[model samples]
Target chain A: QQQVKQSPQSLIVQKGGISIINCAYENTAFDYFPWYQQFPGKGPALLIAIRPDVSEKKEGRFTISFNKSAKQFSLHIMDSQPGDSATYFCAASSRNTDKLIFGTGTRLQVFP
Target chain B: DAGVTQSPTHLIKTRGQHVTLRCSPISGHKSVSWYQQVLGQGPQFIFQYYEKEERGRGNFPDRFSARQFPNYSSELNVNALLLGDSALYLCASSPSFGEELFFGEGSRLTVL
Candidate 1:
């Protein structure tokens, strides 16, 4: 069973626009939610993360808005750039378990 | 410090063959995890090791196995390779369980 489900298999956005990708998980035990960015022929890299305690976390142009009760989280990129074009994955995991459950992934293309 | 490093950036194998992929964690990082990513999909956790001990494993068959060395490096071995096994195998390293992880470039295995 896939614990986390991400929507919008592919997305296209203008360079300076806002790009949003959403994900929902089933396991309530999940406390850590992180987003990873991956370029072609490369491994996924940590982009941003948010814990259940906080409603949102922002790092520069990347932001993670989480809703604990809804069991959902969304990643928003402000002023999206061409460099941001890549595959993004949303993952969830519990405190003790080091294993991460990942979503289906979303491919974003930012047009210049 | 240098980031996580993986070996043999790419490999090609035939059915029924066996292959081994290697990974070296970042300096001072004691935890390593393996993930499998197929085309157009997210990464699925395969196994996690910390301090030379297996901390977590995914729902993979016995044909898939991994071990960590004393230096925090790891090797993933797959026996009797199949066409379905062709995918990108990624290795991630972290300071500890449930901490921020750094990923390597990954080894792309193409099973013919």
Candidate 2:
């Protein structure tokens, strides 16, 4: 079973627009939610992360809004740029396990 | 400081053959995890090791095996490779279990 589900397999946005991606999970034991950005031929880099205790966390232009009760979370990128065009993956993990269950991923493209 | 490093950036093997991939975690990191990413899909958890011990494992078949050294470096071995095994293998490291992970560039395996 897919532990984490992500929507909009691909996305396109104009420069400086707000790009949003959403993800949902079924496991309530998940406590750590993180977003990773991956470029072609490279590894996924840590972008932003949030815990269940916080409803929202923002870093630079990237923001993560998490809803524990709904078992949902979303990533928002403000002022999306062409350089930000890459694949984004959302992941969840529990304290008891070191494995991270990842979403299928969302490919984002920013056009100028 | 150096991030996670993986060896054999690309390899090709015939079906029914065997393959091995290596990884070196960052300094002071005690945990190492392996993931597999098929084309256009997110990474799937394979195994996790902490302090040279196996801490967690995914749902992969018995053909997949891994071990961690005392220095925290890890290796993933696959026996009787299948075409479905072709994918990008990733290694991630963290200071401990269930924390943020730093990923390596990954080793691409192609099964013929």
Candidate 3:
């Protein structure tokens, strides 16, 4: 079973615009929500993360807005740049488990 | 200082063969996890080990097995390679279980 689901499979945005990706999970036991970014031929890098106690977390231009009640979270990138163009994945994990359940991923393309 | 490192960046094996992938976690990290990323899909958790002991495992067949050393490094072994096993195998390390993970570039495995 796929615990986490993410959408739109692909996205296109202009430089300096805002880019957004969303994900939802079915397991309410999940407490840690994190987003990762991956470039071609590279490993996924930790972007930002949020906990259920907090509704939002921000790091630089990347922000994670989480809604615990809805079991949903979204990633927002302000001033999206070409450098930010890559595959974004949202993941969820429970405190009792060491594995992470990842979303299908969103491919973002930033155009100049 | 060094991030997670994976060895044998790429490997090719024929059906009925076996393979092993290695990973070295970041300094001071005690937890290591393995994930499999198929083409066009997000990564799926395979196994997690903490302090040289298995902590969690995903819904994978018995063909997949992993072990961690006292030094916190890990090795993933897959037996009887199948074409369906062709994917990028990623290794991640965290300070402890359920903590943020730092991933390595990954080892690409191709089974013929």
Candidate 4:
């Protein structure tokens, strides 16, 4: 019953490089897709999110590429920094469901 | 401006004992959700509450229960703790539910 699937349990990226994490979900009803970043002993903070209507969304150093047909989404970090070393999670949910189906998770390490 | 807050950053309990975790949502946030994160795994949804009413639940057993207060704070109670229950219990709050959650640092429960 793993509803959301993520890849690469752990990843290593060099500083100034790019780090990517991917996720796919089984439930098509999922309308909202979000990525969260968590540091040790801290909460999961919202990084960026993309709805099904948008194919892609971008922030300062983060981007969310979404594919509606594939039921997949990915988070890309540009100019990865050592400060970006943390665990990342992808989640899916629909309106009124309240429950968010999360992927296994990916630990990203950006070496300085 | 305060974010979600959790109580007792760490706790130790014996098997068959009980533990209670607390969470206070961000200011003006009305929905509270709970999640469990085991080592090397993603967070699994446990429960959600909106307006002091149950909104959703996950596939956890009956030993886990939660409730929300009028102030949008919530509590999670687990009875008869098992070794498998040793993990980081997370609390999240949102303006509504499903997506856009602000999470707490979490309460780590170690069952012996």
Stretches > 4 Å off in candidate 4: none
Q: Candidate 1 local accuracy as lDDT? A: 0.93
For all candidates, the clash counts are: 0, 0, 0, 0
What DockQ does predicted model 4 obtain?
0.80
Top-lDDT candidate index: 2
Q: Taking the tens digit of each residue's C-alpha lDDT, what string does model 1 give over A2-46?
A: 479998899999999999999999888888899999999999999
Task: Give one digit per residue, the lDDT tens place, for model 4 in A38-96.
Answer: 99877788899888999999999999999898888999999999999999999998877
lDDT of 1 at A23: 97
Clashing pairs in 3: none
- Native-to-model Cα distance after best TM-score fit, residue A94 in candidate 1, in Å: 0.9
Residue-wise C-alpha lDDT for candidate 4, range B1-112, written one tens digit per residue: 7889999899999999999999999999999999999987889999999999998888899999999998889999999999999999999998887648888999999999
Poorest stretch of ten by lDDT in candidate 3 chain A: A93-102
lDDT of 3 by residue, B2-76 (tens): 899999999999999999999999999999999999998999999999989999899999999999999999999
TM-score of each: 0.98, 0.98, 0.98, 0.97
List, residue by residue over B1-112, the lDDT tens digit for candidate 2: 8999999999999999999999999999999999999999999999999998899999999999999999999999999999999999999999999889999999999999
Assess each model's interface with DockQ, reporting 2 decimals per model.
0.83, 0.87, 0.87, 0.80
lDDT of each: 0.93, 0.95, 0.94, 0.91
Cα lDDT for residue B104, candidate 3: 99
Question: How far is B98's C-alpha from truth in model 2 (Å)?
Answer: 0.9
Candidate 2 per-residue lDDT over residues A1-112, each given as its tens digit: 4489998899999999999999999988899999999999999999999999999999999999999999999999999999999999999999856689999999999999
* Residue B83 local lDDT, model 4: 100
